[model samples]
Target: MPTTAFSAHYSRELDVEQLGWLLSGDRPGDDQATVADLSQWAGWIRTDIRCSSCGKTGAQVVRPSKARGSQAVLRQAHFRFVDHQGGDGHHPFCEFYGNDTGEARQTDSLLNFGSEKSAETRAVRLLVCKGIETGLFNQATIRAMRQWFFDMKSESRFKVRATPEALAWARSLQRHPSYRRWTFHPAQAEMPAFDWQAAAKFQFTEENLALVELAKTVVHQDAEWKRAGLMAAKHFGQEVFNTAALQPYYEDTLTLCAFVAKNSGISFGKTSPDYYRFQGAPIPLLALCALMLFTSEWEMNTAIAKFARLLASAEPSDLSLGNMIGLNPFHDYAAWRLVILAAEVAERSLKGFDYQAQLTAIESDLRRQHAIWKSAG
Candidate 1:
């Protein structure tokens, strides 16, 4: 049986041994220190710690770079190795050089943050490794997610909206000597240049994972089957139009239409109408909750609560709002509709609804409605 494990390079092993020196900013070579001993140390671990093996400076221990005290201590308790800038500087024959000593196979070790790769690629790899380390997802599943994200890139050119806070953080890192060193590489070195700034902008947290999950889910169009057919779309328009004129119940039809336009990527370009009217928008917050419901029937309440937190904490770029709004009418509609849905679902709970049963019923109705539209047309 091939157990899944992260690779342990010589540099990481050296970092583990020199935890005392790394934390204290002293000389290296405490390879004998135990995890319990490092845990008991009171000082903080700096990002500019030198490698014990190769004397290479700028090795980052897998600690909470932004956290402090006990929280940082807790985070750094494990000795998972992250990539250092440029390279690990180990001799070619060193046991840790490009080594896959972790429980996982050699192939699984391909997603290395330390390698000379693009910042976007490193960010993706970081997410996968963090997901595996934290039990947010399995390695295999995250690998699939990584592949999906790469495959779906459109010439459309997407840029995440950066908040003031994100920008400030990036600025602070740019000013720091350690981070500056890590971000910059000797131009003529064999190492590939990377965007360290971009990597630093994304954290391997639950909120980021949700954002990534949304991107992956939207691109995959997993909900395509539930989308309204041409007839269904026309019929839905007709029904909404009639109801809007006749009753308050039908008033939500316009809102629903608007939601479809915004959340279904209409602003970006042409997209299926079924996205908005029949299947519902895969809004990052809502889609995350919905995915949880589909995967784990018992965790419904937890998923709903998680959705609420994600919605509240979300940044505009986190939801892809920048790309979906302000460029055209589609953008305007999507931006507004997302605001509307957020208000509507803010305090709701999922306890009363059997989501599995509801999904099955909705899918059936969609097929029937689409068929009716086709026949009438």
Candidate 2:
């Protein structure tokens, strides 16, 4: 499928289903998270991620982007959305200006970013910096790194965060040893900054882990995922089936992202996996379900129904964790996809990663930027 079509479908799915879920407040208490808390949580997730990519154990990534200026808010995002439109006319979902086609003037708010820190940019910047620091990463590598971090944190949506220095630091880390693990490729000559103990300090708990498991399974199932494909059969499949590979990766690195984030307690980005899934409640259960359905290769239909029943049992009379699988606006599939790729890189560089899917999502999201869209066209 073309990128536009995939995004259109994703948007349509969210507009119709996910929107109702968000508005209806139908998710399990597990997904319940306050944006107020998300900042600090995101900081922690970054800390763990920092350790993994930068090889820095003694000095955790400093969260310098916490206090932001007023002009850096989401107002400019409005213009970005406008630019995304490219005057190509709005899709069926757009209704903000009360019109679909015809050029719309940029609103004052459109010229600004929301006071909210861009979690997506800041978080991804940390990962992106890993790219820059490690050797000369190509633009595609940068894209992959950025896309991966965003997916790991947001699942698939975008997160906004931190300040200018936050972005700069993220750039710096990529240059360190961490960015080399962008996709679990062949072999990395770069040594990690932290020893094993430090790696264990930070980790992803809650929903972040839940989503990582899902994304891992996704990477496993995808034939396009070269190294992971081999590893998946050996680890995700046989290990789960016979050898028991699921928890090792999570224990050593993924969970480290969480533990590190929790201990570091920095607030530079939007929604770090640390912040959102800081605890071990709702996200874990969701992850368990995802594993059963996606990885175990068990009865998927039964798994879907099981999760559906779990969602049904939750409050609001109607909600399912599955609904947000790839559509949550707060960084859904796209972010987690990166996490999966990064995990692969942690062990070794892989010629695998589903970037095409991610690019499609980003291109579509860019359209939502409006301003970027107009400029692109």
Candidate 3:
């Protein structure tokens, strides 16, 4: 089952955590709620929520509440699909299919970072180069790539030595003549030693700290907005931040921002210099390489689609070059900045690689996968 559901009322997807916040009577702009308001919103969700992917109704929003037992226990809110007469199920090719089935898993030993000649590796390298050149690379894309890698690792049929092999293979890719230009350069500033395992750790501590610092500067003008900012930071700290897993917290973060805006009447339109300062922080080369090597066309396309929606919904002023370079109020500003930095590094490193052949190979593979899925369906 998916952790997120599409809300027809809002015309956007929301995770169960966000729904839980709403159930507590927290509206998009206000934290305060009355019993009547809570009941009303809960009814709204029951009517409007549906499958994010297939748009199928019969999706239910489960709120966090105490269990009816001698020792009462609290449960976390989540989304689930329910069956009833004539109700539609998920689409045949939806990613949710086979997710919880007891199907045989692929063996890790059988899953290798194939040689340079392999189509998957070439496709990944080419896509990264193209993304940087086209100015489309961002945090969501990076997250998608990482998610693909972790999905593979998690689906291994048998336990195998993965980390050591993955690290060595990634290092070899980084050292290749075509990739070396981007991974290492004499004129570039000193970088941390290449460590795939270490780089995989999502160190949001610095970003969260920077966000809190930004919030502090705004306290003089809007105390409620400041509170919302701090609350968002705290929420980030409380949630598990893993580069390798699906990012449900991103929705949670956005929901918190929406709450502050709707409840407190604070406009996040004006650009803040402090937000821009933190955007300039450096992302590691090895991490970028890891992202490129594991990313699939499907994952990249999904990420790009979501990013496109964010851009389409943003205000014209929010799309200014300076605002785009740093954080803006449109989406997850901190995450967006990270993507920008990553793209810069990627573009500089992939300056001279030939991309045409890789593109051809990728398109061919995509067509083949689509055909197979179609036949299966």
Candidate 4:
């Protein structure tokens, strides 16, 4: 069983809570009719839902049945795989395979270990920072950390903070170590300064410059490009237009370049409105470049260059590229594929450690984490 599934219609993953909200006709901004009845909703889930990890259809959403004229709720809704004639089902690597219950228990326990101010939490944060600085952590460790951070935000019961220095180190390593949404948390509020400083000081090697030049010659209309742009804009609070007219505009790219150039100064800090305005521009561009890799017309050199620019922009500290790609490794098989492609590119072009092997290790660790949790449970 799984708590999250991907909805093809939305081009994004939705958790059981979001699905239940939609089925109750209370989804904000959703104009479509919803099935208020749990039974009907379960039928719809069978038809519409797919395993986020395996991308296989036939996953069913189960909600606690409401007694006639009663209001008490007993349990939360979740997704479970249904039996099919063929062996087509969740992949062996899927986190939900025979370990959902234990995984959930372990995740909850780990997340609730301490509060933001506790010594335990601080020790963990320091360990993460040290691991990043010394290159002691691999892709598996990074993936585990990313999962922990993501669950902290989504689950609502846990709230943890990472120092700006820790976040900067994580970003320098091309790993996202924060949540998707920026809140009023003090630590989060203080991050833009560190992010801007890192971006301004970003050094582009000769190879990086050449790759950027190469990327300029490659351009084509990919639907994923538009979707990436729209989602990025939505994430950063930028105005979005209709998808029909949303293509990669030269002006937007130029604007991004200009923003990078102008803000690449020592004086620009969090207080500057422009810092807030363009701090997040690179993320969408990175998303675009990542999606391009999946298209038939992808260019490896071009992707490497775009990824370089994303690093120079420095706004990715608060957002996960995996999440922006909408193929979280825990839920979507495509995420593993994307990681493999990205690892290959990074190995050849990007600086840092053996990210190629490290990225692949994320899948292994995800499986291992489930097994450990199941055994402990």
Sorted by TM-score, highest first, which candidate order results?
A: 4, 3, 2, 1
Task: Provide C-alpha RMSD values for all models, in order.
Answer: 27.6, 26.8, 23.8, 23.7
Q: Scored by Cα lDDT, where does model 1 land?
A: 0.28
Alpha-carbon runs more than 4 Å astray in model 1: 1-139, 153-377
**Candidate lDDT values, in order:** 0.28, 0.27, 0.33, 0.35
* Candidate 3 wrongly placed segments (more than 4 Å): 20-43, 65-75, 86-89, 97-377
lDDT-based ranking: 4, 3, 1, 2
Better of 1 and 4 by TM-score: 4
lDDT by residue (tens digit), candidate 1, 10-52: 1222223234444445543322223324444322332333322
What is candidate 1's CA lDDT for residue 130? Answer: 38
Clashing pairs in 3: 28-258, 28-259, 29-259, 29-262, 29-263, 30-263, 106-157, 182-349
TM-score per candidate, in order?
0.18, 0.21, 0.25, 0.27
What is candidate 3's lDDT per residue for 1-377, written digit by digit as tens?
44446555644344454444444644342222111223455546656876544455656544434446642324323454554552334443233332312112211111111211122222222333345434555434443443444354345322112222222222222222331112212222224454322221112212123322322221122222232243234333232222222223322333333333243332333433233232211111122223332333434444434333333342322110110110111112233222222222233333223233333444454445546665666
**lDDT of model 2, residue 259:** 38
Looking at model 4, which ten-residue stretch has the lowest summed lDDT? 108-117
- lDDT leader: 4
